[model samples]
Target: MSILKLGALRGQLEIKEFLRQRESVVFTLAFPVILLFIFGSVFKNTIAPGVTFSQYFVAGMVASGLVNTGFQQLAIAIPMSRDLGTLKRLRGTPMSPISYFIGKAIVVTASMLFQVALLLGFGALLFGLHLPTSGILWLRFTWLILLGSACSTVLGIAFSSVPKSGRGASAVVSPIVIVLQFLSGVFFVFSDLPKWMQDIAALFPLKWLTQGMRSVFLPSDFAMKEAAHSWELGKTALILVIWLIIGTLLSIRTFKWSEE
Candidate 1:
């Protein structure tokens, strides 16, 4: 088969396998909604006067979905696949590593998009969130989503390179994801966070992604008022691109097709 057709088939199969896992389905679609209900209810009338709680939560929810699919899933699954000899076996086939990566990327990207849609739909129907009216706002959202996905995918591969075994994969990734969720303003408003915490969070890609997304969904007049207030789209894209490059280099240099 042609490379394009082969990659498409492999991607479809990977997506199907991911969908077959009940826990994955629940976490991807339901977990964010549950969080929305909890947070939206508790903070309903308490968020800053100009900011609607639902509108504020939508950006964070989308960020969470990106993390779940791009970082959490890939970090755990790639190592497991390697440990199970899948990567080694695939390497021996006519399928190139590039094709394998293409398939994997397609599966994860598709899954993330679905998760974003579900979060947006849930936020709209239940919490009365509305879409951004400006086309430029959507353009920013699209840029942030794609950049965040690329950054997360690379970082996931980099982390997968260090895991001693497939069994420890989730153990390592879960804490990092949880910490990021907190620091990235998914659970708390960045402006209310301690200055030190904001400084530390600024070092991570997650913060930039969350802030960039918030700029899109939040009112144009809304400003972070914290160190992260200014959303430098060019700078954000550059940082993600750097992470992507570093991750790519690390993956090439350190990744092992089979358990060592």
Candidate 2:
């Protein structure tokens, strides 16, 4: 077979395998919705003196979904694939490593899209969330989703490079993801937190994504009260781009095809 055919086949196989795994689907899609229900219900009529609970929770959900798909899912799966000799087996095949990665990327992107749609649908139909007011606002939401997914996927690959074994992959990855969820303001309003805490959280992409998402969905008047106090689309785009670049470089430098 030609190299192009080989690559396409590899990607198709990867996607098929992903679909066959029920656990992955549950973890990626259901888990986030569960959290949304818990948090959304808890905060439902209890808005902060100044902020609406639904609005706050929506931002947090977007951030949580981004992390779950981009960082948490990739970190565990990639390393386990390496440890199980999947990556090793691929190295001996006719398909280029780049093609193998492209296949994984396609799978990840598809999964992320499904996760996002499911969350949005659940949030709106059952939870009373409204759609964006205009096409421009919806466009911003799209950009945030793409950028957030890219950053998390690269970071997940980078982290996978260091996991000790397939068995330990979730152990190492989940803690970071869970911790970041709390720190990323997924469960609480960051503005209500102490100043230093907010400062530290700003260093991560989660904060940018959640805040950017809020800017898109919330009223323009609300943006004026944000910490950044403005949409700052350029900053959001820049931060995600930098993280994607850094994560890509690190993964390329550190990733191994085998348990080396």
- Using all chains and alpha carbons, the TM-scores for the candidates as numbered come to 0.93, 0.92
The numbered model that scores best in TM-score is 1
Mark the regions of model 2 whose C-alpha exceeds 4 Å error after superposition: 1-9, 46-51
List per-prediction Cα lDDT, in the order shown: 0.81, 0.78
- Model 2, span 1-260: residue lDDT tens: 66566657766887788889988878787888888788777776745344567667876787678788768877898888887897898788766766665566666777778877877888887677666879989898888888888788788878887778888989998988777767766777766767887788877888888888878756677776676678667887898899999998998888788975
lDDT by residue (59-117, candidate 1, tens digit) is 88898788888888888999899889988999889986666666777888898998888
Instruction: Using lDDT, give the best candidate's number.
Output: 1
Q: How accurate is candidate 1 locally (lDDT)?
A: 0.81
Which regions of candidate 1 are displaced past 4 Å? 1-5, 224-228
Q: Name the lDDT of candidate 2.
A: 0.78
